[model samples]
Target: MSNHEGTKGNLLAFLPLIVFVVLFIGSGMLTNDFSTMPLNVAILIASAIALLMNRKETFSKKVDVFTKSAGHPNIILMAVIFILAGAFAGVAKGMGAVESTVNLGLSLLPANLLMVGLFVIGCFISISMGTSMGTIVALAPIGVGIAGQTEIPVALAMATIVGGAMFGDNLSMISDTTIAAVRTQHTKMKDKFKVNFLIVLPAALITLVILGVLTRGNAVELAGDYPYDWVKILPYLGVLVAALAGTHVLVVLVGGTIFAGVIGLLDGSYQMSSLLQATAEGIMTMEDLAIVSILIGGIIGIIQYNGGIDYLLRMITRNIKSKKGAEFGIAGLVSAADIATANNTIAIIITGPLAKSIADEYGVDPRKSASLLDTFAGCWQGILPYGAQLLAAAGLAAISPVSIMLYSFYPVLMGICCVIAILIGYPKFKRTDDASASISK
Candidate 1:
């Protein structure tokens, strides 16, 4: 095909994504009920539109593209994680892990310390697991339950969980964002972690202090009969320990499910079929997310084939002239990709190479560049209503995603920190020396 024809073809491929956003976002606005327009239905319509748009290809070839995108190993792996997460969450709740954990927390913590405690736990779990999604999934239900006991707003509690989750997601060595950043920038994971930790730790500490002071005067009555002992909380501890050890998330979740099941069974709280039923119910709960995942994969695949991403990169970076400009460009690139794709890991993968190029040309540190990619994409993902984290939190809390955004202190702070890092060069490196060393090989 001619170059012009190739460009045109690629542009045509992006129409489906446009359709998806307009249909999903518009329908939600028009109906004034975001849940009224199901995510899966929107994805189905977009995927079908994409399939039809590729009319020039043979039917078999079109099927191959859709199937390949839908069944990509990463996509499949994520689907499996969703399924297992659902099961684990259901079983854990069925066994009273969430109730016990919440009761235990409320018993131990003063009312004023609740939000801070939630934030601290979120950071610990995400740091151990190296994935925000896992941390959010494991903790959100508990957060919701705690909200009911304390009369705390569910959105506020959920925001605390999200903030802590992002804290770990940005700094954890095993996280996909961290791995992608380090690998793309050719930096050691430990080195990048050090830099990331320094930049964001202060913000987290400040947020904790703020939350502590805000809740100091507010106290809630605790139920006398609530389970506040240490033993009933073992399942959460087990999940945290396994995740920190770099166990695969699926494995961590499966282990958690087994532990919860055993605890429930031993306690005579549930029968075997009830346990099985909990697993099935949990898996079924994520049906919307699973469908959204496959549909998004297919739609994005078509967009990639059409050169939409290339166009975006070119358009955004057209004005870069200095290290600071380059840094902002990198942030904008990934943020835009995230807005388009509604997936942070995918955003990083798409923008990483291009970000590397920009960094190399402008003598930006790979470590810093990597940090920017992960941080900004995560920041955007945290606030986006359609993004998995927000959606999952919303689903669990039964609140609007916009309400969650109002209290998402971490992402806002992180974004400010990222921009400040660029301006002040907090993690300053010998750029020329680093560049020479990198080019030497």
Candidate 2:
């Protein structure tokens, strides 16, 4: 294809992404019920519009493009993962996993240490599960409940959850963002983890200490009514163990669901029909996220077709001159895409290839580049009030997403650490001779 044709194609690919943001984010702002405006409807509309925008293609060809993008293996895989996650979360809750886990956590910690403990738990769960959304879903309600009893600011409580969730999301080896970053950058999961851990570990520790200090004097009486402690905590443990074993997210979730079902049945808390009902409810609960994911996927596909990503890449990399500039370029590439898409994984996916190219051109290490993509995209996603993590955290805590942003210390710290790493070149890798030759050439 001619350069012009290629550019046009890329531009066409990005149109759906623009529409999704405008519709979903804009409508959420206007309506004040982020949950009320269905994300799938927005995606369906954007997909249709994308299909229509292919003026030169035959109807069948347009259908083919839509199918190709929508049914891409990655998209299908994510959908499957989503289903399993939903089912697992639902079943686990029904089986009393959330409450059990909460009780277990509460049982172990002194009241003055509750806030830091929740943050630490949130981090551990997210890191193990590789999903901040899952962590928030499992813990935010508990955090809220704690708040009601402890007189803690709901925003602070929610922020604790959010901070911990982001910590895991940024560092988890099994996380989708981690997977995407590793695959895109052509780096080993272990290598990426090594670099990412160094950057985020300090931030997490500092945040924990700060939280401990802040909540040291706010002890409250613990509630004591729930009795499913051991069994309830089992589901979360099952999921976490499966995830840490490198089981596929779907399998891990299925394992969690089965565990929840069996435990619930043995305990007589739920019948067979109730298990099914819980599964259905879990699936139903993902309605908004499902819609948002589909729409974001289709929109991003359209944006890719339109060369919008390329345009941004060219614009951002136009003036790269130094290591710091190259790092800034990497950060900007992912951050801009994230801002446009409101999905960190998608942003990394879109920017990965170009980022690789930029890294090669500017003599940046692939490991560093990979870390930058995940870190910066995560930073933006964690802070965005409208993004999924914050939204879920906010929704579960019954607080404004904006409020959570103000207290999101970990994400902010991660960003600062990334910048410092780039400037000081800590954890630097020796570049391959061939890569060095390419950069010089």
Candidate 3:
């Protein structure tokens, strides 16, 4: 393909994504229920449209792109993580981990601290699980339960969980968003984590303070007599320890599942058949997201092959005149993609290469760009009604995703901090001594 052809994708190249989004909203509207709309079904329909585009290539060539991208090693690895994450959640929660963990935390905290405690718990779980969606699934119900026990609105409680989930989503070394950002930018994971932490810490602190102030002067007391097994909570703790120790994500999740299953069996929480069945059911539940991941990967590959992404980058960055502008450009690109796709890791993968090119072109630091990509993608993903995190949270809480957005303080705060970083350049990095170092314009 000629440079002109490669750099000037037709507007129609985006029809597939546009179609996907329209179908999602349209189905939700027609049914008067957003949660019932399936994203995977939309993707399947959109993929058919995507294949018809980029007609210059042979049919086999297009199929090759779709299949290859879907089966890309990273994509497959991401799928495995989802599987293990689901199994772990299923086995652990089935074995009484979720209830035990919630009880343990709530039983130890004052009423005013409930929201803050939930937020912190979400952060801890998300960091360990490396998935905001998983964290919300595991904790949003507990948040709703908390709301039932206190004067807090259910939406506020759910938002607290979302806020905390985004914290680890942005900072966790094992998170797919973080992994995609670092791998795409060729930056060290630890370096990206450090930069990400520096940028988000203030936002998190402010969120906690806000939670405290919002819930002050209230006391909640539970009337239930439920037992919390410290042993059941061990899987979460073990996952946390292993993740922080830099064990690979798959290892951590698989280990967690095994640990939970063993604990369940030894404690008689599950019969042999039930334990096996629970883990299988848990993994089955993740099919939607896992399939969406693969399909989105292929769709993104097709978009890139057709120069859709290149055209997008050129249009967005055309007027950039400084490093800060480039950073903002990166932020806007990823955030927009996140909103449209409703998935942060996929957004990162779609935008990462272009962000890298923009970073190099404008002398933006790789670590900073990686942080921006991961942070902004996560921020948008956390609050969008149609996004997986909010959808899962809203569904679990039996509330509207829009309602959850009302109190989506953490994501909004994180987004604001990201903008501030772009405007003022916090967490500045030193240039590499090597010749390839990017110096600000």
How many backbone clashes does every candidate have?
1, 19, 0
Clashing residue pairs, backbone N/CA/C < 3 A, model 1? 10-306
User: Which stretches of model 2 miss by more than 4 angstroms?
Assistant: 1-4, 8-19, 22-63, 128-162, 172-194, 213-219, 223-228, 341-346, 384-407, 423-441
How well does candidate 1 match the true structure in TM-score terms? 0.89
Error of 3 at 140 (Å): 6.3
Of the two candidates 1 and 3, the one with more favorable TM-score, higher being better, is 1
lDDT of 3 at 182: 96
Q: Give Cα distance to truth, residue 97, candidate 3, Å.
A: 2.2
How would you encode candidate 3's per-residue C-alpha lDDT over 150-212 as one tens digit per residue?
789998998999999899888987888899999999888888887788888889999999999
- Per-residue lDDT for 1-441 in model 2, tens only? 122345423544566656755776678788876555555676677777777775655767656555666566665655555556567777876776767666665677787788888898888888887887667766665687667667678888888888888888888888989999888888777777778888777788888888888787787666775344776777777766766666666677677788889989999989999989999987766555545555555545555554566677777888898877888899998998887667788889888988888887887777778999999999999888657677666544555566677788888888888888777776756556543221210
lDDT for model 1 comes to 0.80
Ranking by TM-score: 1, 2, 3
| Every model's TM-score | 0.89, 0.79, 0.78
Cα displacement (Å) at residue 20, model 2:
4.0
Global lDDT of model 3: 0.79
The best candidate in terms of TM-score: 1
